[model samples]
Target: MKKLRYVKDEGMNKKRWLRGGVAICLSAAVLSGCATGQDKQGSQKDLANSLKVMYSGSEDYFYQEFGMLFSAVYPNIELEVVNTLSLENTLLDQYNQDMNKALDAFIEQEQPDVVLLDPTTITSLIENGKLYNLDTYVAEESYNVGGFNPGLHDYMKDIGGGQVYAIPSTFRSQALFYNKDLFDQYGVPYPTDQMTWDEIVALANHFPTDGAPSDRIYGLEMAWSKELTEVVNVLATAEGLNYFNSDTMQMSIDTPAWESIVEQSNQVLTSDAIFYYDYIYSGDYEASSESSLGDPFLEGRLAMKLESNYYIDTIEIAQNNAQDPEDIVQQWDMVTAPVGLQNPDSTGYSMFYNLFAINAASTNKEAAWTFISYITGDEFARVQSKQSYGNIPLRAQYFDKGDGRNYAAFYKLKPINNVPAYHQVPQRFVYEFPSMLQQEFASISDGQLTIEHALSELQIKGNELLATEIMSQEELKLYLQEQQDVLGPGVITR
Candidate 1:
């Protein structure tokens, strides 16, 4: 049994040492290899094989990040990564009605045993019976997946129409990072788990906002830019309100729910307690702030900011680069991202990007299953946890990086049931809609337009924009098919 280790933030030596230890443990447990198909009674004799994998990145990168570690445990099984950049580019070049035909040809020619796909592509393939079902394999091996994030397996099963077709080794999540010292200095209480958006804003209002532009302390900073629309979008997403209806191809931003969100967001934006990195440094202090350092939160000025798990990497890098001990963000921790008032138990800020699945047409199902199982296993997650900065491990225990910090905050809330409606809308619509919103919001902020009149005007303008940009159903289908490769492998194919 493996026990967790405590890691100090003064240096990254412990992280490096632990990663090295994980490699050693993997070598010692070579025969087990997560006890997938390769380790079974009759499978071991036939384990010597070369497995082909389709990945979005270069072969060297795949080998460096994953292939090397896997080889340490399964020396006989050769891992071949089939880089799809060229194939993806070719698909992107000629995007039309025959896009699926071209994709089919590419798949037949490549015949990769395993493939890394986006969630949307995974769903499409699952629907078309082009992906293998892993439920039978999982049940046969009695694989214990109870350690994964809550509802994650069920989420995948739902995507695959009641069967598990793909698995993600890691996911992306955001949390509310607060500076403990700032809270203590301002005599404000620390934020807790499952906070509602309104509750968070109310708490932020408690902090004093009087000071110079550069030296001021802010209660909250939700985004890097001063875009009120961006902050409003976050709040609206938490509330499960679709500002655009994909099926109808119309704007839904004028609704009461949206109106309320905009009103609240406007209040927060006008309040001096909220900080926008761009706004703060746009004037005389711009040079000083830029010269002083990176990340005001790290600079010990911002009270709290809702940021992604990647922020940990930023913090670690700051600590490593700090020439003076005083420059470090000495005390900080995180809590769950803000939720909606009605649904305070879940958040919409979580996403799984790299989904691994076995090709149903492959003759090497055994080997492919072994590879997939190994990558998604608890042991693999343990090693990967220390290696990656932005990715949240699928396994529950590994979330605790032994750093004695509140790692649980990243995974504390259940993911919202629905994917964002914007994903389903046309790509052009999604890209252009935000600008229209911002223009109208700017008018309201300048006191030239009332909220009611502004929303009404927005609804009219948005419909016109949608009408001009909308593609026919069949055309939309072909467009999505052709553009998947162009958007890169990580794009969600909603």
Candidate 2:
């Protein structure tokens, strides 16, 4: 019975964030051999156990394909899969409710052995104790926690209260993808993994300003206009900018970290070197188009762009299906994404992570761990990495293969500790606050507001929103009472 901490407010249940930074102890568990489950090496009978799995994202391809792979490995073990629907899209209210009901009913009736959920749904599942704590099995088998991306292991620990509730099976992080052919033509040295945004911007302007009449070309393209939130997030996260004060709960945008991000953003906004991709929804990601505003790299219009591993399949598809394969991405390569001025570990931006966990109330706990261990093993990672499933395997070595080429550097960069509220608030406020402040950002970009005015406006408005969000018990009561007083006894005469 671990002491699990949770947010007290019912509406804000999504705020399952860890307060104060804590070093990962699971790594210690791995070394100390401190786990407690029966280390049962299994036979065909153990392998014959039937397991239920819930896949939160993907419907048609991922599950159907993985089912075959899992079957080939353990011929006797049966996998029953149910998809609650993809979480990649903006969750609609009715859809959210329906999916919630389906999952709730599934868990209640089926009592699944394993659950494959995304980060967005894990919070709710964790609160309900649908996922099991994996400490015992991990310790008993000496499961190496250090094998995972550093920050993600920390995140799992925080989510599970010093235990392991979920493991990230797939992940995709932003990287600095460059065109070697373009760089060669310009005689500009390839971008280094450690280069800063400021440094990259300088390099982007090095190529010829003039180009062919039909398609435009640029030295570098961050596509920041499409991923503005990520752009802002990476820069601010590097400086460890938590949006609000823990004691006061007041939002503070006055920090030097925020200032640095704004300055960097302004540099990009002013440079005209970036390509502003369209903001079409995520569902249209695979559809054919002119690389959308979000992907100048894919259309061969730009030398470089910062993007996630998901882009690899898209580029491969474009190359394989194109009339000419050599021209697509034209000798493309990637390096670790640039770190911010504050945290120089070369980590920032976002990564789409897929999670796996044993159901907390499962009947076949031991056999379930057996299945969980095998599928998440390095061999499975290797197999899955080469597939067209679009999931980037967690282990780096899986990307080590291929024609002396593509994805050689995939594992070189590490995942960042995504600061949930970076400001000690919930993600809704963090995302919303940034969006609201976009007006000021636009003001700065459009030259309507000076940097000073923009900063002041962002601070003032951001604080007001934060105040509303973090209202104290007393504050809430007073506010409600004030509203009641305004109504003045219901006006019976009316």
Model 2: residues >4 Å from true position, as ranges? 1-42, 57-62, 82-110, 117-131, 139-155, 158-162, 211-216, 224-252, 278-301, 350-352, 406-408, 419-435, 446-453, 463-494
List where candidate 1 sits over 4 angstroms from the true fold.
1-43, 92-105, 140-142, 245-250, 284-292, 417-427, 450-494
lDDT, candidate 2, 1-494, per-residue tens: 12212112312311111111111322232222212111322354655368777776454334443555555555566777655543222222223323444355566665778777555455566677777888777665446655654465666676566777877766666677888888888798898866777788788888765643225566765653444444565456545566566446566676666766877776666665555443223232222243232344655657887766666655765676666565567688887676666666636554535567888888878767766775666656655655544456766666655655546345554445443423234333543565566666676667787766777777777676656543333554475566457655542121
lDDT of each: 0.70, 0.58
How large is the C-alpha RMSD of every model relative to the true structure? 8.0, 13.3
Clashes in model 2: which pairs?
35-139, 242-422, 242-423, 243-422, 243-423, 244-423, 277-293, 277-294, 278-293
Best by lDDT: 1
Local distance difference test, candidate 2: 0.58
Candidate 1, residue 417: the lDDT equals 48
Model 1 collision count: 0
